[model samples]
Target: MIVVGAGIAGVACAGELVRAGVPVEVRERGRVPGGRLASRRFDGRPTDTGAAYLTADDPDFTEVVEGWRAAGLVREWTDTFLAYGADGHREVSGPRRWAAPRGLRSLVEELARDLPVTVDRPVTSVRPGPVVDGRSCAAVALCVPGPQAAPLLDPALTAATRAVGEQRWSPSLATVLRFPSRRWADFRGAFVNDHPVLALVCDDGDRRGDDAPVLVAHTTPEFAAGHLAQPGAAGPPVEQAVRDLLGLPEPAELVHVHRWTYAKPTAGGVGTYHLDDEGIGLAGDAFGKPRVQSAWRSGRDLGRALAERLLTVGG
Candidate 1:
């Protein structure tokens, strides 16, 4: 089996298949795993620029989070976030969000530690035999955003093609701003509603538990759409928006922006995963509410389903 993605979803699927006594390989186009759980180092410190944080509610996913917590890879962030809208800024309580001291990417890396994962190797096509780039496999799982997966799938594979076609995605930009010191009121995270440029912002220092005077902001889909070509160009505006929202006195000393063309699914899928007679599987956050847990569950369910089918056929 081949999983053509190294994100949490892909790694989770591979883990299940391996437990089922199925040999599997993971291929990733990027230099590292993590996908949207992306984190980047700036000034010798890891900052979460992709997903602000994650929440766990499912019993299975809660167990996974507990493992991450015991391994010192994750920490309970906060249940409350400040929401800024037309009226004013107010604290909103929600589920307990989790964060990683090392960065969310580390969690994905930990899961992939024992898997046969190949980085920087992009799979070009998934053909009729469920072949990956001309190599026939027992099965192939495309654990990626539907927009990205759509291009790699051959039109001859109707089941997978139709699945990808029915999905819709949106884009966003994550900006990291480093200031001389923390000048704004302390807040873990903030939701900027009705904002022209910014959508969400997090105090990276607080989130990382490092006290580093750094802030990470996500741009609205509408704003991100215009700056998709050059995400770096969005840094100034994103930084400005953050400063304005938080009423910071000084400008950021440094700013970095990362682009997410398909940041999230616009709507949820009908099922947790998709598997067909073609022996191709599709799993990702798109399969349910777009979240870290959703991606994990989607891949896990798909892996179990595939293992049953393969084992039965072999028997």
Candidate 2:
């Protein structure tokens, strides 16, 4: 068995397969295996640039969160987020969001530590017979966004191809801003509604629990769509928007931006995963809500199905 994409979902799937006694390997196109749980180092500090935070509600996923918490990789950040929109600025309560001290990427890495992952090797295609780039495997799992997975899947694989085609994705730009001091309110995160440029903003210092004057802002998909070609150019407007939103007294000392072409799925799929007789499986956040826990569960379910099928065939 082979899993493509080493994000939390992909890694989770691989872990299940390994436990089931299936020989599995993961191939990731990125240099590292974080997928959407992306984190980058800025000024020797790890900053989250992809997922803003995570929440655990499902019982099974909550258990996984407990393991992370026990390992000191995650901590409860906040349950309330300030909403800014036409109505007015107000605080809204939601699930308890979780953050990582070493950055969200660390959580993905921890999950993948025991898996056999090959990084920086992009698979060109997944064809009929469930072959991955001409290498035949017992089964193939494409754990990526619909837009990304669609390109790699051969048209002959109708089920996988059609499923990916039905998915709608949106893009976003995550900008990191470093300031001289923390001048914003005590809020940890905010959701900006009806904003032209900003969608969400997180206090990285607060999220990291380090008290460093840094902010991470996610741009609205509409605004991000215009700057996908050159994400760096979007940094200025993103930083400016954050500064204005928080009424910062000074300009940021540094600005950096990362683009996510398929940052999120417009809607969730009817099933947690898709597995066809062709031995091709599909899993990701698209299988459920666009959240880290959803992706993990999607992959988990897919892995179990694949393991059962393979074991039954062997028997």
Candidate 3:
């Protein structure tokens, strides 16, 4: 079996297949995996720009993340999260959120261990044996977004997937703030439900339990849309929006902006899809909803289904 996309869904799927005694190759378009839960280096420091944080309430998700935590790749974060609403700011308790020691992307990286993953290989198309470039495979699993998946499939499958549409992914603008000294914020993270400019302000440095000297602020969807049309628009307005959200008299030392065109899945079909004739399957967070836990479940269920099918085929 072959898997496209080395993100959470792809890695999880490939891991399942490999453990099931199936040979799998994971292909990724980017240099590294983790898709939206991405990380980058800034001023000699690394910070998480995608998938700021995630909480798991589902038992299945807990088991999967627990495996990751036991591997020393993930850890538990405090439950206290402050909410800055119209009334005022107050801390609240909720399910414990888990974070990777290095970054959320690290979890994906760890899961991909021992798996043969080829980076920088963009899957232009998928077909029966002997496609473009003379590549051949027995089975394929597509972990890309539904819209992107439509074009790569056979004509018959294309029509069925086209009904799913381009799948409008919610846009997001992340602004990272660098501070010389630690600025005290009640708790590690704050949620802004009814704010105009900022949506969430997070002390990722403290959240990671590292003295990384960094803070991150996210803009509301409306705010992100207003300026996302332009490529470089995330600079000034992002700074202004972060300042407004912080409700601070002064700005920080420096600010950085990251724009995600396909941030999260807004819509997907009824459930996951598998084409027996095509000898492949499809799964992603976009398969249902845009959450890490949802993605994990999607991959697990898809992997199980594919394993069952593969067994029947082999037998």
Which of candidates 1 and 3 reaches a greater TM-score? 1
Cα lDDT listed for each candidate = 0.92, 0.93, 0.75
Worst 10 residues of 1 by lDDT: 262-271
Q: Output candidate 2 Cα RMSD.
A: 0.9
- List the candidates' TM-scores in order: 0.99, 0.98, 0.88
lDDT-better candidate, 2 vs 3: 2
Task: Write candidate 3's Cα lDDT for 175-211 as tens digits.
Answer: 8887666655446888888776677778878767786
In model 2, the runs with Cα more than 4 Å from the true position are none
Model 1, C-alpha of 230: deviation from truth (Å): 1.4
User: Can you write out model 1's per-residue Cα lDDT over 156-230, one digit (the tens) per residue?
Assistant: 999889998988999999999999998987889999999999889999999999889999999999999999998
Candidate 1: which stretches are off by over 4 Å?
none
- Model 3 scores a C-alpha lDDT of 0.75
True lDDT of residue 178, candidate 1: 94
Model 3 scores a TM of 0.88
Every candidate's CA RMSD:
0.8, 0.9, 2.6
Least lDDT summed over 10 consecutive residues: which range in candidate 2?
A: 267-276
